[model samples]
Target: MTDPTGVTITERHEQDGIVMEILEWSRLGGMTDPAGLPLLALMRTAELPVRQLRLTLTDAAVVLEAGALQAWHGRIEVENTIPAGRLLRRMVGSALSGERLFRPRYSGTGVVLTEPLLQCLLPVGLQDETVIVDQGLFLACSGGIEVGAAVQRTGSALLFGGEGLVQTRLSGTGFAVLQSPVPDSELIKVTLKKGETMAVDGPFAVLRSGSVRFSVGKSAKTWFGTAVSGEGLMQILEGPGDVWLSPLQPVYDGFAALARTLGPDATEAAESGRRR
Candidate 1:
């Protein structure tokens, strides 16, 4: 299906009473450089597409991150139901966890569209359980789910785990939409039986079942061993549940940092030459 602005639905995901469509634009407008058009077209062809979320709600409500709603149509009522007594607590939690300060709820039968995003959107279903997610990953969720904050189990973990002191926690039964650093295909889900454990050198494990216990530990038994192995502290999770890891997250992070550092200066030089 195509939106009124000519964006087309490129993909659809439906499960457990949730229906979401990914809308894509064929080409971007308002480019500063005509010469970059070929490169942008090639990127689109390579599936680095500009995308948005189109959610269809039928007699249900969804909680969304503040300022996420781009457009909506039909019988929808939007509200922020956070209690006055808990407002300060919620604000402090949001400040520490990197989550939005206010989450608005939209109810009734209608279509809700979200702002376009370059990151991948991952829809996760929970069945009367809880999941601990990395900071800033939450996008939206069914209203039945409870969204809160969780802290590291230990001080060392809080200091060295690289996942921040507080993370987003989603509990109860419903679907959650998360902004992922990598596509679903690149995500690795590891299910562990009781007493099992997993460890990684970075904060690549984005989501884990609430039953899983998280901590930080040395990669080797001793300092000498760690130096020889060239690995230091590692993020450790012991579980009777699941953990989702994005192994390629570091690569993407590195390139993003490079772009941020170089993009503005390069653009300024080009514009200066044009003026000359």
Candidate 2:
């Protein structure tokens, strides 16, 4: 799966008239300093793959997240297909669901590429089914799919579930690409039977099928019981469908926060305080 441009196709997915290739760079360039060489070697040893998506389309159309298009080739036409009548409604839905108001649609035959991202790209297929995903997870989808907003079923879920009042809902028969915080290997998929329940303490549930119901409830019968159990409110999902959970997302978030705190600006401030 190696390409002439030093990019390797780590994964490939083909479904519903689209071919997607997950490209990863074997080695990064542009570093000239000897000191940076050690850091680069360390990054290679750590296996931190920088990935991107390459899509091949033939007489088909796809909708991409705003600003996701990096480049394209062949005969392709791009347009914002927002109808004037639904402009106001789309705007409000975008605000509540945290999705961009305008998603560019690319139609015709072409090879499309998206900007390189550190996050993992997950491709999901649907056959007359629907799935609800957390906001900001959507990257691209086939034109046959319908993208809309889904509101929280209850007030407690909206307030305590950690996901906002609305989430992104995708329906119809096609494929969708989602930007996941963690790699697919780390994701835990749970299929629940009818009336089965799953509870989580954090916003670790990234996605759930449309048949599932999301809510929030106390971990124990009372506040005192919850405190004693060391668990408080939990996000609850009642289902007869699939749910994808990323239990390691919180660890990644903690590391990112620590990196920000120890960034160059903080280092410079510390040096100034020491000098003073």
Candidate 3:
């Protein structure tokens, strides 16, 4: 049968249990390693977009891209497969979850957020706090996150020096690590899907909801302006890799350089434009 996105779904028998809903892509993240292919390949075979990917078991001799999966895509050996029960037995003894796979799926909210615009949580099972956010970062929470005047407070479990802690506020909350984008620095692109609009400082802004209006001004407190339009859409942001949140030193250095280069020119141009 076809799923919500018109992709077909079906079930098939494999080495163990059943491979349900393989996707149509014939590949996992462009990987061709026979020994380390994701089982999602089965879902791809069935023609789905892998809205969500997760590992049911780790250390079960399931290999994905030849990694240990201490993090994301990791695997064991196909030639020497271990039973799921054995895998779980090890985890139960070690007091850890054996499932260590990543699942990437479309957001039911029709939105997708990149690392710069999204926040990650640690002690994740215990804390539901928002740990970090860039000044004009985009967030594609299936259920929209708090923002604008309505945003009162947010929390996060920040990582520093290989440890985690609670951060109640964004500023002065200590260093929060952020994943850097691919390209270092230059121009970034933020694409707005249909019915989506955004309102933020132009240089740093990514995708905005289509329902919002974009304007330019210099009101320190209310620096940007906005208005509702329709069902808001997702924002796609692309820019320098350094846009990520790093330790205060690098962040401050970047900000300082920007201000130094722009401060005088900005003031002069503003004055020139006014006189014209």
TM-score of each candidate structure, all chains considered together: 0.84, 0.88, 0.17
Q: 189 in model 1: Cα distance from truth in Å?
A: 1.0
Candidate 1, residues 21-137, lDDT tens digits: the string is 877775676688977865565455555767788888888888888888899998999998788998899888777767677789988888898998888888888899999999888
What is the full ranking by lDDT, best candidate first? 2, 1, 3
Clashes within 3 Å, all models in order: 0, 0, 31
1 or 3: which has the higher TM-score?
1
Candidate 1 wrong stretches, greater than 4 Å: 1-10, 13-18, 29-42, 260-276
lDDT of each: 0.83, 0.85, 0.27
| Cand. 3 Cα-lDDT | 0.27
Worst 10 residues of 3 by lDDT: 117-126
Candidate 2 per-residue C-alpha lDDT over 35-137 given as tens digits, one digit per residue, 9 for 90 to 100: 5665465456667777888889988889888899899888899998788998999988777667678889888888888998878889888899999999889
Off by over 4 Å in 2: 32-42, 264-276
Q: Given candidate 1, what's the lDDT at residue 36?
A: 81
| Alpha-carbon deviation at 246 in model 1, angstroms | 0.6
Best by lDDT: 2
Among the numbered candidates, top TM-score falls to: 2
- Superposed by TM-score, candidate 3 places the C-alpha of residue 9 at a distance from the truth, in angstroms, of 24
Instruction: Sort the candidates on TM-score, descending order.
Output: 2, 1, 3
